[model samples]
Target: MTSTLILGGRRSGKSARAQALASTFAEVTLIATATASDGEMAERITRHQADRPAHWHTVESPLYLASALQQADAAGCCLLVDCLTLWQTNLLLAEDETLLARETDALLAILPRLQAEVILVSNEVGWSIVPESALARRFADEVGRLHQRLAAACQRVELVVAGLPLTMKNETGTR
Candidate 1:
């Protein structure tokens, strides 16, 4: 199994790049984490849905991402997770105080063992100005650290900007 991590700023085409890569596989399952909390977001989600192939399976994974991945994984299949930042947001806003730590640990533990070709998309949010709220700052810190760990686990890592993807590390076919 090969795992890839794709990071980029908003609208930088990281999700599109992930989608294109996953398209190489015959079987694909997309794990969508964002929730349509507002009308604008609902429209964005709809547009994304319209972009994907109808036959490609999609799993709405808000909190239990590891479990969702585990259930969807299959040898020779491709699993595309279209943004970890929203997943982080969901955990942070949830009532369960320990949800973030628990799920984070679970995902970290499971990534390397998954049998499918896994592509994870996340925003590189540390580039922006420091957030005003303590919660936002905490999120920045936590996500930055999580990116580091994910990079180590992933065989390939990419950074997309201005609709271009720059390979950060690639270890495909090495294992």
Candidate 2:
């Protein structure tokens, strides 16, 4: 299956780009990695859900992303994973110390074998200044390393900024 990784800063149109790319497919499954832990977050999730096409199937995968992807994959269908950073945050805060590496490894292992077209959205956090807190620093570092590995595994990689997309890597070598 063809796969692409879309990276961008906050509100940089990464999710929009992923949606546009997946629009070509006949069937779409949006695997969301967000949980409404607070009132503000609940509002944000509601807004995001309202923005997406109602016809698209939605799967809530706050932690076990790989398993969700596996269950949702279909031939000729498109699977869009909106934002991995949230997923990272969920893993980071989990009580199970081994959960992070286990889930991440599962995701990487399954990406190459999926039948559906894959479009992944992730925040580009490497550009910002280092965080003061150790947890924040670890989060940044983990996200950066995850992006690198995902980029290498994916067939195409694009960076979005100001609602514009720039292809960073394309195995097809075409514009």
Candidate 3:
């Protein structure tokens, strides 16, 4: 079956919902896109790691997410990418934007061929006001565009608000 996309604002319960959905699968693999570059980020990553079930396998990939997905697919594992926003941040900061674009394209192209269930979680950044700084604005735009593309790629799409989920694109076995 094809994967699903869960989009929501920060702390809007998107990750929680994704985790719940992932639990249905026999083998769950978490693809972590966050990198610990600073103390705050490290703490955040720690908290996220603590929140997840101990049995779920975790793979840290701040870049080359498409390759990680392929690995998960090869293992016949259900995959949950907790947040795309952080991955976007990592890409934007990278010196090579071309690599980011290539990786994203590869990810989109490979998703349909994969056998495992996949759940992609991303922030709804377009709902907020325009960012003040140029870098922030660019990051927002990139993330928003990525979210749009992934949402279309998925078989099911859901928007979470106030910890409640509203299905945007409903599909069988998604409830």
Report the candidate with higher lDDT, 1 versus 3.
1
Kindly list the per-residue Cα lDDT of model 1 for residues 100-140, writing each as its tens digit. Answer: 99999999999988999999999999999999999999999
True-vs-predicted CA distance for residue 54, candidate 3, Å: 0.8
lDDT measured at residue 169 in model 2 versus the true structure, 0 to 100: 94
State residue 76's C-alpha deviation in candidate 1, in Å.
Answer: 0.6
Which regions of candidate 1 fall more than 4 Å away from where they truly are?
Answer: 173-175
Worst window of 10 by summed lDDT in candidate 1 = 166-175
TM-score for each model: 0.97, 0.97, 0.94
How far is each candidate from the true structure, as Cα RMSD in Å?
1.4, 0.9, 1.5
* Alpha-carbon local distance difference test for all models: 0.94, 0.94, 0.86
**So what's the TM-score on candidate 2?**
0.97
lDDT of 1: 0.94
Local distance difference test, candidate 2: 0.94
Candidate 1, position 137, lDDT: 100
lDDT of 3 by residue, 1-175 (tens): 6689999998899988998888877789999999888999899889888888899999998888888988877445688997888888888889996877887888899888888888999999988899999999999888878888887788899999999999999765645
Our tally of clashes for model 1 stands at 0
Looking at candidate 1, what is the lDDT of residue 98? 98
